[model samples]
Target: MDQGFFLLFATVSVITALMLVVARNPVHSALALMACFLQISAIFVLLEAPLLAVIQIFVYVGAIMVLFLFVIMMIDMREAVLQRFLPGGNLPALVLLVVLGVEMIVLVFWSDSFSVATPATAGGGDTIRTLGTTLFADYLLPFEAASVILLVALVGAIVLARKEPG
Candidate 1:
């Protein structure tokens, strides 16, 4: 049952992620990204990380997606959409994708790290407490720095989206 659920979520996640990349419309792309995030959160739940799953939904699907939609709405995309996609323009991307696919296949098949299967351990009662402590105590500076960076980006987006009065 668990394996079936995992496969279902994993398949949906992959499909949504592909949709996110392939969608031409910015709003549609953002919606696909949100769906991908939601699918990822479901996978996290299957992995027994409920906190991570909730955080994934709250942070990625909620806050980050809202920020993305705001930026998308602020931008004028009609000109971009009107531009035709040249077939030759995709050559570079296709080459990179094929190279990456080959690399991933080689890594998966030849890597010693994945040869051994490790037993899954049950989470302790203090799992969340330990995670919180570690994040706050050791990673607080980096976390705060990331937040500040995101805030700056949001402000920058707003400024760029603002039009000068004639």
Candidate 2:
């Protein structure tokens, strides 16, 4: 990848990720995350890693983002979550956040060092064929489980929307 393109992606993606976490509104945060994902996809393109880029967009942006939006829309955002009632319990949350911050800092600096030279398994071609084959063959059980979970979620959501007896 060209240094300029990498730099551009790094700057934009990092900035948008920061904005994603810092945004007060959940919708804005999701949009920022989408921008971050797209910039990362562009970086993958620059590196000739079209498979990763496609997966990033398809899984993260397409499936995961839609899930997030569905969750956001399903929840009653108007309900106030009292600070005292929140699960974090304040002090522990602060400590966890600090630890996470340190871990992210270490990862951001050293991640490039972890790249390995794995020999390509398939001929240079569109990766969808191999991905689909693996998804349908070896990982079929987990895929079916995921489908069941999604089905349950859909049913539960409908149940939650029904009026209860007084």
Candidate 3:
């Protein structure tokens, strides 16, 4: 049962993630992203972590997606953004793709001898208690600093975009 669920989840996640990247329409891409988030929340439920699943659904699928959709809909010039093309043009894109292919080949062949080992952590599943503890203890200052920085950046961007009197 769990294996089947996991496989379905993985397939949905991969398909939606690809669609999110490949979809020419921005609104469709955002919908794909929302699907991805919902699938991830379902995976969390399958993992027996209800809190993470709730957080994933509420924070990512609900609030974040609504905000993104609101912003996307607010944009009257989405066609212009969609029609925008890459710089250095088609030749550079093809060359870059070739370089990426070579890099992928190198990574696959050269890294054959190296194997990644998982870290030996005691608790595997995420818990709200532990998450809160770590957030308040080890990462408290940095998290607070990041919040202030994001607030400042938001304010600055708004200020910069504001029109001046003629």
lDDT for each candidate structure: 0.81, 0.76, 0.73
Q: After superposition, how far is residue 140 of candidate 2 from its true place, in Å?
A: 18
Looking at model 2, report the run of 10 residues with the lowest lDDT sum.
79-88
Best-fitting candidate, scored by TM-score: 1
lDDT (C-alpha) at residue 138 in model 2: 100
Q: What is the TM-score of candidate 3?
A: 0.59
lDDT of 1 by residue, 27-108 (tens): 8899999999998998888777789899999998999999988988887777556777887887897688679767866876
How would you order the candidates by TM-score, starting with the best? 1, 3, 2
**Model 3 lDDT tens row, 40-100:** 9998887766777999899888886876676555554544566667766767756876697
Model 1 local distance difference test score: 0.81
How close to the true structure is residue 50 of candidate 1, measured as C-alpha lDDT?
89
Model 1: which ten-residue window has the lowest total lDDT? 113-122
The residue pairs found clashing in candidate 1 are none
For each candidate in turn, give its C-alpha RMSD to the true structure in angstroms. 4.0, 5.2, 6.1
Clashing pairs in 2: none
lDDT, candidate 2, 1-166, per-residue tens: 3666677897799789878866767788889989999999998877667888998899889987887677657655565233225555667855876797689778866887435433345665756688789889999999999989878976876665555589
